[model samples]
Target: MLNRFKSVVSNVMGGLPAIPHQTEIPEDPNSLQVKFHYNRPDFLFLTSDEVELTADHISRPILVPRCVNKLPWKAGYAEVINAGKSKSNEDQATAMHFHIMAHMTETLLNKTDNQVEMTDMANTGGEFDNSLEYTYFAIFDGHAGTGAALMASNTLHKHIQERLLEVKDLLLCSNEDKMNDILKKRNMSANVNLPTKRITKDSLVKGALETAFCDMDEQIARERTTFRIKGGCTALVALFFGAKLYVANAGDCRAVIYRGEEIIPMSTDFTPVSERKRIAYLGYLQPELLHNEFTHLEFQKRVHRRDIGKKILCRDALMDGWFYKTVEEQDLKYPLIYGEGKRTRVLATIGVTRGFGDHDLKVHSSDIHIKPFLSPVPEVQVYDMTSCEHTEDDILVMGSDGLWDVMTNQDTGRIVREDLRKFSQNEDSRYTSAAQELVSKARGHLHPKGRGWRMENDRPSSGDDITAFIIPLSQLNSPSCSINTQNGHIPEKLENG
Candidate 1:
């Protein structure tokens, strides 16, 4: 399948080629660098400063390092040495957290803008007394600009960590009316009368992830005027604590795990098409937000005033049915959900319906801010990895959409299994190597005999910035395993909506 990043922001932003632009490399490559490729049409990255990486993005892609280089963190990074509530000085688990990137597909932009962070949550001064016990992993895919993605990579986890106590406290407190109101606003089912002791681990984690996204987005918007940061990014993160794994996402990025050969998605992708009703309903409730320029009702193409009063098939915002309605004068307005597929956009100004950044951004020539429609509320998913039976091949793959655009969850699971079968963890080219191979397959190699040639089932590589982490859950099995996630990316350029 052709990997075409939708031009979600192009209606106002201008157009560019869908293919990734590459610069000629000098003979004898100096070094290999893993960079984030924001799937935008514009080369918004201006800085050349090297970012300090916490994951294995800089070092060689070796899954099982043979002491080739000093590991950034101690080996068995995922090993949860602290089994009980008492905080231990030793690092958590031995389950490796390795990040590898291929300089993403974009034109003329040499520097990669994507960022990832994996660390023991203990270091960050979170509100939770047991903060030292959890592990955090996230991938921030930026587009249009790098500032937002960079900021998210550095701060989102901290927000999550800090909110841990707030969420738990809120759930435990007796403030029923306030808690119910908050839960209702988040669209979560509310049961404030339930005793605090009955609160499930899932509820606490969900409240934490949701509240963290809210806090993170608020911070981003506040910092926009101060930091002059433009653009936005999708966040996918995983929080591992005790026996449960919490996965949360705000954009197109994905998290997939294997229950033996069965593929399960830990997070949901928030695209215009998937979020049509919610967006349309928001537009319905607040028509002024449309500025008389867009309609909550969506259509295949633009609706001109000339077509007013014409009968057309339409999707209702409140109902789960498709019916025909006569195009009123209001129906001729620009659609709230514009375009189609990957390119479909919520407001014709941005591609992603949810995520962080774009705070100071306004619709071109108008003071109307699009941030009102965009959100940072992540869909958090919980998995009991601790309860599942383990196999050597059982792995958790978290990747940017670049990997998913070309491969399905099943395809990824199959490839991972095959790679392990061919190259075991005992070999140097283990998980990280398999990740690179998976990236290569999604981002097919260049022309002629490569990705350009397009084989019968051409799955050579991804033209987007490809970053993936292949975690060995089998190794992290120290009586407990937990999880959460981050997601989304803006294209470098967008054609007219």
Candidate 2:
């Protein structure tokens, strides 16, 4: 019984290999003294203040006090976690700060993962710029590994800043008509007789964001071997400047804006089920991607090899119901679409359909790749926030699937509204505090005996990692007070054209 007890302890200490970055805890007495190399130092082991940020560096040209060190204001942050490795608590809320120069995503010489950065005002503006400053926020949710998230968090803003800087030139070149319209709206006439260029701010900004996402993914794939980085992550970013709000996302992570009392989505959550049509379309184009091992058809469940030549039930096109048909040899093959909604997976492995990294991902227990089906391009949502009205209660909420799994966007909005109303008299009830409240609700309550956990609704607790950012729209949109809502979603460049 003692030997069995030791075996169980060893297994528990190791956790599951399926969980990314987890390994077998050693049985050796001096194992703690051993230097176990990881892609980056565990933030769990560092104090929130000690974590890196752009503001912390003395070399920052535009030096500013760190967010954590600054006097509490309209915008703030909060986090809670029931899991992770730490000498103390499993929770970590550390954020890194970085300094950005004139619009350029400097090629990072180092490789890393699972990071966060903030900039009060990115230097992305026109020379005759109407807007003086802009703020940027993002959340990188890592899976399989953390490298992609860290790299993207570090460099994506730079790419955007650079692209936005060229807005004037692009506007002159690409869309002379639209550019003239915008200039005319400002009551400024451009020298239309001058040589016209072929790019517009619309096209430039769109191309830059999509390019940055893909570049970051490619960088992660290239550096994974050298950096020993594993896994992949979701990228959700928000760019609020002047009269416009740009929210771009490339995974299951999401961004939403709560204006007045309504819920406005800023980004789309890209999952296997949400992208079934696209996934099926790709599979149709490249049947060879199936490796003759899978079919693009949807069924009640995975079709069995022995089920060949038998009639079966399968789904047809989008929004259509499953129909009865005789199973062919192809039907007997494995399914390209597997799992169910949310848990719906691609190649029967990855749950997310769009994200960064995972370029080298192979099917579980097999060598077949799911990367061909994975993409890093983000869907860009452009919201003209300049013309929208706002209230102090209005906010922008960003969170990973962990929070969404237990709460719908509408439910979350209602909760925030109720909390703000109930705590209106509390002076300390800032946006981040509200974010903490939401995270706490999802985290649920620990058992009386300190065992499992459950939520107020009597539902199960969130089993995945959770993070939330509650940015006050008043704080961000105060001076601007401008426009609102999740407006039209525009794909990048000529892709839409």
Candidate 3:
């Protein structure tokens, strides 16, 4: 994992890999390690050979799913390998539809002789409003290695479903009357009492999402000791449940909604530059995490040895504005965070501040662990899908940092709008075309004579891995996809524009 990061820093240095302190982990010959092979999303339907071909840095082909029907809502997807940054594409994505069984709720509520029993009500085999169906979309941007991203793509949704099942009963209780009726019918169990404070259904769903992310991260940490999981990854997930859309993000990947003439941001990037204070505060709280080689304070400029005992413009963990402080011997240590914008780094190591794995990640050659300063918690945002009237033109575009590195939210919306207008109303492939257009625009054209890739505006193109998903919000607005309170069976009539 550190080797890949070293290559990135090496490329930035315009020469050989210059980061010397970072080293690769030596494999133990006697220990058994279960490893997961790299491959594209199964929905893409690419053969094993084709998956390997997609990683070719020389050709750098943009890959999309074989059929639009592979994804629900006829979602569009596209991805491309980096310009030799790593041997394989570190980014991975997932699109899945999950059904919460009615029995799951009864299994939790049914009881007999102080023991939970699968009673007749639990095995009724009947559909009810208590059951639910939801769609999940996620992107994992891996760094160093693809192990963490691969595991996240393969298992994160299962964790989410597990958490959702735990709260199925509460999710069904929409109001006080419904909750009281269900509680009374279940027979006054002291073990299952409502909270002292009022809790909204939205809060239950959000908590499920938040805890799911934590569970996924914890699994990675626990299994890595016995498995071959390497490095870490940022997770960005969008859950379409009931009549609401919940976005939980813990990394640099972003999600934006295109509605009419405006672009709505659904997720925020968690980078060292954006979350400096939170990381700095942790450093200040536990100085031992820094190993005495780093400080929680940030200065406008690097403090030289001569500057010691002199006042310098600085900002501490709590201060936002810079203030003059005398530089002491400890202040001469490296700042907890360094650089700005895309160049920002924590301990002069990783760029992102939140995500999964990275339990063994340390600062270069030091013993300081980076995981303590990193977070697995995601920032969640919710949008009521029923509150807005969305048309076929409206879409939710989710992409890794590679896509956003070159294009702004407005630029992406404009391009998607332009591409969607090119196809007729009945074209189902338009969404895929729109996704392809976004990847193409971000990747740009490779130049000859070793000049490297250049964007349409003559700027350097993104050399990192790129992945994007274009989901039509029109499906969410369609009556066929909505929950049926009377029959509990939603008609499968989701169509693409």
What C-alpha RMSD separates each model from the true structure?
13.8, 11.8, 7.2
Model 1 over residues 1-497: C-alpha lDDT tens digits? 00112343343334432222122222433342223232211111112221111112212121222221122221111111111111211111112122211221222112222222222222243334422245556776666656567666656665665556445434443455666555655553554454333345467778878998888888876765445444677888877655567888888888888768778789888887788888889989998888777778765455566777777777767766767777777676667776656666556656777788776665544555677888889898988876777676677788777668778898888777777778655654466556655655664434564324121275443445555667666655442222112222222221110
Task: Return the candidate ranking by TM-score, descending.
Answer: 3, 2, 1
| lDDT of the candidates, in the order given | 0.55, 0.57, 0.79
- lDDT score at residue 179, model 1, on the 0-100 scale: 62
User: For every model shown, what is its TM-score relative to the native structure?
Assistant: 0.67, 0.70, 0.86
- The top-ranked prediction according to lDDT is 3
Best by TM-score: 3
Candidate 3 accuracy as lDDT: 0.79
**1-56, model 2: which lDDT tens digit per residue?**
22322332233234422212322223543333311232212322323342322112
Error of 1 at 312 (Å): 1.4
Q: Which 10 consecutive residues of model 3 have the lowest summed lDDT? A: 109-118
Question: On residues 1-497, what C-alpha lDDT tens digit does candidate 3 reach at each position?
Answer: 33434444444334333242242354782374755678777667566667767877877888876567657777888888899988999999988655556566434322211111213323546454667668889999998888899989887877787788887776776675676566565654656555545557788888998999999999998888777787899999999998889999999999999999978999998888889999999989999888877889999887867999999899989888999999887777777887656877788778888899888887765677788888999999998897788888889999999999999999999999999999986687889899988898898888876789888888899899999999999886342222112222221221111
Residue 48 CA error for candidate 3 (Å)? 1.1
